[model samples]
Target chain A: MNKTEYLKSLSNELGHMPYGDVKDIIQSIEEHFDEGLGEGRSEEEIAASLGDPKELAAEFKDGVKFNQIMKKRKRLKDYAGPDGRGRIFVILFNAFVGIECWLLLLAAIIAAFCFLAADLAFIGLIVAGLITGTLTEFMVPFIFLILTLACVAVFLVALLILGIKYYAKGLKSYIRWNKNIWNYGLGED
Target chain B: MNSQIKKGILDLCVLALLEKGDSYGYDLAGSLARKVEVADGTVYPILRKLASEGVVSTYLQESQNGPPRKYYHLTDAGRRKLDSERDEWIKFCGEVNEILERGETGGKADE
Candidate 1:
């Protein structure tokens, strides 16, 4: 078969594919023929080497069909939205269970800060006692008490910093999880 | 080789060839057909598939003797895929050879 006949047959066989794809395939094949002819090969030789137009068309059709199905599946997946029951369950769980857990965490964090403030206040009271000479009668014991209090305050400060850091991280991840459930349902990464 | 088997490996082969350097459709088809028993037209569909998958990209370059040729270049994704697919192919071949060699020994022992 000559180049024209070969392309004609291939184009006819590719009737099921989109026009753009068919055009592109035909153009590429035509260029293949042109390249062959440029190298002093006959149209018939190139056409023969390319195999049957029907078979080539079948390959192209299969590839195109597979791609179309994949694209359609992706579109369907996007259109599916989050499952209603799953979303409702997530919402209810967040409202009833998750909210209580979050509130408890908030309360714990606040209580921790309160304790840290009280430690600071105690340290201030010790310093005041030292400055006013009220604790001069028990100077040695009072010094030891102030040093112990200072150590406790340092430890509390460190604990509060770490606790706040982890709490913020956990809260951020929890919010992300809720958003994911709301948008993509369960088990969809 | 079975056509089905050949079809599966053809994609990998095309990617491997492109990984070497950018090549036009005709050159790729010629090279593949020389080594494998595929028709010259077979590579086009695979190229289209790879292009659609974003593993390979194509550009038209002016040819000195003929019309502009569409050159296929391997993308980064294509290279990574080649590495993984090559490893899998090697492992698969090893397993197949072992099984075939065992079968051969079994057949010889029976004889």
Candidate 2:
């Protein structure tokens, strides 16, 4: 394709993006052609080397999306900086991030383990109570109580794992996005 | 070279050029095209990204040829980034070279 056709196609494909970004990409392409012509190269030569404009536009969109994610992610950086505000945002962010979230999960796990162990001990005590003649009347009901507590602990641990599994998936996406940015900036190094 | 690899280093290559002196889009892109297998239009996006990230800043200068052109200069952050990346790149290449050299001699030794 010639220079004009190539750029028009790219601009059309990227029309959904913000205007300035499209303009910048278009201007950059124009400048590329301009320089190529100045250096005694054909527009076809440059265009061929640039590959399909559709592909180029896709890359441009990916780049813009990546940059937007990076900017949105920088809200955390801003909150870390002096003069942070937006208490609601901070609250929402705090629910999902930092040492506190992990600690909360850990607390739930520990609480579940303690309950499970306690239920087992209660079961042992109830068996002992039934085997001997001490507190024989309370044995059956206490056995049921231990069974209920064991079920609750198992349920609690399962819920925590499911919740953490979702959280881990979200964290993985963020890490992947971060890796894209890193590869863009420092991957060659 | 792989285009993916090319995309990763486009910013570093631009920074390497700007570290020498300020350069307009066309000039830098031309030099890069001559040296690297990168697309001519890729440099501007990187320059825009660097400017937004506060790594590099730009100013318009009147060109002798015709119109005013945007010339990019490295910021302090850009300088620090270039330094660290350059150091890491050297070390990375050195390690790769070591393994390559080992393969070259070690294969013979195994025989």
Candidate 3:
């Protein structure tokens, strides 16, 4: 299957998961395809390497669902102890989490892509600067231009790295957030 | 072996690799699968679990060929887990190896 089809089937299989989780997982998988291309791999090769999405989904469901059951049992005990306010806490918490999940994913997505775009732009500038230097036979000016482009390229690359790091950190927070929703979003004591 | 057991081993292997340095998902998977039999996508789920547990964290690094890669790094918690698990595994395997090798001599003793 192609990237879109693979992601669609995976998400469908993961239909029971928390909404934010499904988005983050699918986004990371999409990023995987992009990375695979970087490694000189075709979509089929990457998909094949990824093995079965259904199995992947099953593992995810197993880990998170297992935790959910345990937390659910704990929450049940707390609610059973004559605490009416606990019910409202559970409802309000899940409602707030449900609404904010996708927005978190969107912010990370935009940050990652912005840095990526900037990185590419600098690479393009370097190439253009080099070509211009070659055609004019201005060796000294060309050297200066290329060196300046290289310095900017390095700086952009660093920024791209930092952006990606922040994006990943944010994604992990979302994963933890999603896991909490499954495992303790029910107002666990 | 059961898949759960295999997955546990895979988890340890991933941790050990990350303990050495950070690695992107596909690269880490490729390294582990080379050393052990595994499905291609298995590492991603393991990664998600680790991330949730605060045992591992991730970042993006651009590769020469494709889009940026999300690299996994071991946290302090992951390192501790790996150390304890590795010790347990070694002891467990040493005992099992001793038991299995005795089969060679046990047959002779019975005769």
**Candidate maximizing DockQ:** 1
Model 2: residue A30 alpha-carbon error in angstroms: 1.9
TM-score of chain B of each: 0.95, 0.90, 0.87
Models 1 onward score TM values of: 0.63, 0.58, 0.61
DockQ of each: 0.60, 0.22, 0.37
lDDT of 2 by residue, B46-110 (tens): 77778878889988887665556778899999999999998998899899999999999999999
Best by lDDT: 1
The per-residue C-alpha lDDT of model 1 at residue B103 equals 99
Q: Write the per-residue lDDT of candidate 1 for residues A61-99, one digit (tens) a residue.
A: 889888878875765578676678668978899889999
- When 1 and 3 are scored with TM-score, the better candidate is 1
In Å, candidate 3's interface RMSD is 1.4
Sort by DockQ, top down from the best: 1, 3, 2
TM-score of chain B of 2: 0.90
What are the lDDT figures for the candidates, one per model?
0.90, 0.75, 0.76
Off by over 4 Å in 3: A69-189, B60-68
Instruction: In candidate 3, list every pair of residues with a backbone clash.
Output: A38-B65, A38-B66
**Candidate 2's residue-wise lDDT over A27-128, tens digit each?**
777866776677788989988776677777877777777778787676445433232233343445556774476577667766766776776677677677
